[model samples]
Target: MSATVSPIREPLIEGGKSYHDITVDLVRSTEKAPTRLWWIAFLISVHVLLFGVFCILWTIWHGIGTWDLNRTIGWGWDITNFVWWIGIGHAGTLISAILLLFRQKWRTGVNRAAEAMTIFAVMCAGLFPVIHMGRVWMAFFIFPYPNTRGSLWPNFNSPLLWDVFAISTYLTVSLLFWYSGLVPDFATIRDRATGLRKRIYNFLSFGWTGSAKHWQRFEALSLVLAGLATPLVLSVHTIVSFDFATSVIPGWHTTIFPPYFVAGAVFSGFAMVLTLMLITRKVLKLEQYITIGHIESMNKIILVTGTIVGVAYLTELFISWYSGYIYEQFAFFNRALGPYYWSYFGMMFCNVVSPQLFWSRKIRRSLWWTFLMSIFINIGMWFERFVIIATTLARDYLPSSWSYYVPTWVEIGIFIGTLGLFFTLYLLFTRVAPVVAVAEVKAILKSAGDQYLAPNTEHHEEIMKQYKDAEDKGKVYGSDHAHSESH
Candidate 1:
């Protein structure tokens, strides 16, 4: 007797949907009126957003003194939040651009929402530096435009200046990439719609037709943008890291900052993506399109990036000890055993220990555990930022200037407000746009379609013969006709 082997199964999509079915299922979300849950979520987000706006206005009127910053701790919650949000935006590019270039079919399900999240998160991140300037009206001084200040220009060598160029370019390229992907789907909506929707979608579709030539162009354009965005994503966080690494501060001055920050960014970004997608999948009834397999794949990425970030943390400690620099060693020591030791430990637990749960296949596949882990990762990443910014600044070499920094209600409100802003935009996006890429989902349907399992070669041949006889007998097959006829 010969041993039998079962074929490995992999489904990037579920429900055995056709291309037309995918278009209808995804586009219906945009066409339908807001559900009760959507309304409730939107209203709550709006209220929170309004509160954030009020806080911003109040801060503007009260000036920078409303927050808890002193001479010792010049940077606090504002910069921390800025870096945190920016880091969260990295997963979008990684999923859409990097994964696309690498030919990862799994990206088709989640890339649309991930890219949108990137835009919203970056917008939220951009607010902090502007608001932290105190005189928000004079924020244009960061630009290099000629002014009446007699050839005085923004410092060309500053990483802060580099951030302006980097973020703007990133946002622009991401927007174009996202919108370009949406064009064909928008045309699909326009064709299926009537009256007011027809007119609106027509405009949004930018006169796209399903011509072969057009698709060829679209594919080329997408590939080019993905190529451009790959480096931009790496550079953006690298420059952000420069904001710290280039500094004279002991904790901030390390050559490892670039790669460390990039890994942390991807780690945090994936966490946020999972957090939102899990909620969206449940509420929007999109489990078939964004299946359990998709969740598992994303969890694997979180585990990998989380491990990388953990390694970076240990490397930082090792380097601090090996450098033979007193300030650097003390900075690392203080982070682990200082007034903010709780936060440092929190970072270690959330970022390093919690993700280790995913090593088990059962835990990786469990929705609840995955969601909880994602939230924990975000919490750990936030504390990591706080530990870096506060612990180092609070305990400088000069004891006379040493003071613990704490965020005031104003700073707290601003951070919460940014959350409100991000959610508001995301919720609105869910309503107005197809949360998943309809076209890409349709393309992958063949791979994820129903499969027949046979225990052995004989069984598989027997099953195929039966199907062949049925086809020869003029039985109508519902699957791809060419495939059935060929057999």
Candidate 2:
């Protein structure tokens, strides 16, 4: 009888890619010189970064007056962008830590790039609060660290200080976890390179020897880091929500903010991951590794989180009305029907209505449609933060004191500058390393690869070469360890 195949199951790695094929294909982009397309993208990003730097310097020279902050609406695009960036960073840790714990094989395809996105996005997020302080030089006043100016201490009670602690800790853990995974992969590149390149990669890989002992330590360390990072995925965003939830402002002081913010973060995080990967898969000829199956898995998450965010929106409205507090009711009412009604509606359409389209399998799996939807979701998430900040502050208690918050060209440029900085960092990351996790991807190849799952005549012959001796002698092939040897 012939071996039967399960129709319900699909290959995680497509194109019947082999173990050898994985190394050559994944490492090819990094080995080759930067393409003309990469150059074009890099140049555009650098130009944007330069313009943003000029704007930041202009703000510093001109003072906070260069921004559009006023008596009524003191917060503007700065804080909005800060929260937005932090939300974008959440998916990296979640995918790397939570999925690892649960043993989800699909996460292997995208986790490396997602982790890098987290670091870059957090770096972008950190830039805003420092600049928002106006007296950028005295930003140290917000920190609890002792300085030459005596034992000056920041208020322990301040939610903003809590933000400084939570975010910094989150970044530290994420960096360590990300780099640990890169070590083995770096050794792979080191083995393949010559002269200066080999030396550099050797240093980066920390002299990895592919020994059983080395693999054991790597696996143990990954488990420990995964355990540490799992809590951070929940804690970081929950702490961020505290920035608004702890506030006295009508729209800001709600119990739902914690869960609401967390869900919205995951929602936006997956969308961003999708956005970057869609472009990357096409650009680097990685459609086989980052396949349609991977896209569908992530899209399913976007759908779930998007629905949670929509419910949170409704809950906010219902609570404001149910509380029978006029100011509270008006706070949300103004968001829906007041001066910033456009953003409120746009947020709803993008975060709620757009994601509903993914209920259909074909639509969620369509790369072009998914790309377009991911962009829309990111924009909507940005609008959600804007609504929470600008709309709530713009139409506060006294009608006469109410003023509109507008971002000056300086503020706008700095925001764009952060975007440029984020992309610039990511592009450099793609150039230097395998954006996909080569080691982890190879680990799952036999279990999840299409050719391995259902071997044809060609696959059967290759399998015989790889396993004939082991099968006869009942011996293992190198202790179930990945054969990391270079041909």
Which pairs in model 2 have colliding backbones? none
Candidate 2 wrong stretches, greater than 4 Å: 1-7, 148-150, 455-487
lDDT (0-100) at residue 377 of candidate 1? 95
Error of 1 at 399 (Å): 0.7
The reply for model 1, stretches above 4 Å from the true place, is 1-9, 451-487
- Candidate 2 residues 153-208, lDDT tens each? 88899888989988999889999999999998999999999999999999999998
- Evaluate model 2: give its lDDT: 0.91
- Model 2's C-alpha root-mean-square deviation from the true structure amounts to 9.7
| Candidate 1 lDDT score at position 410 | 85
lDDT of 1 by residue, 393-424 (tens): 99998989889988988888888889989999
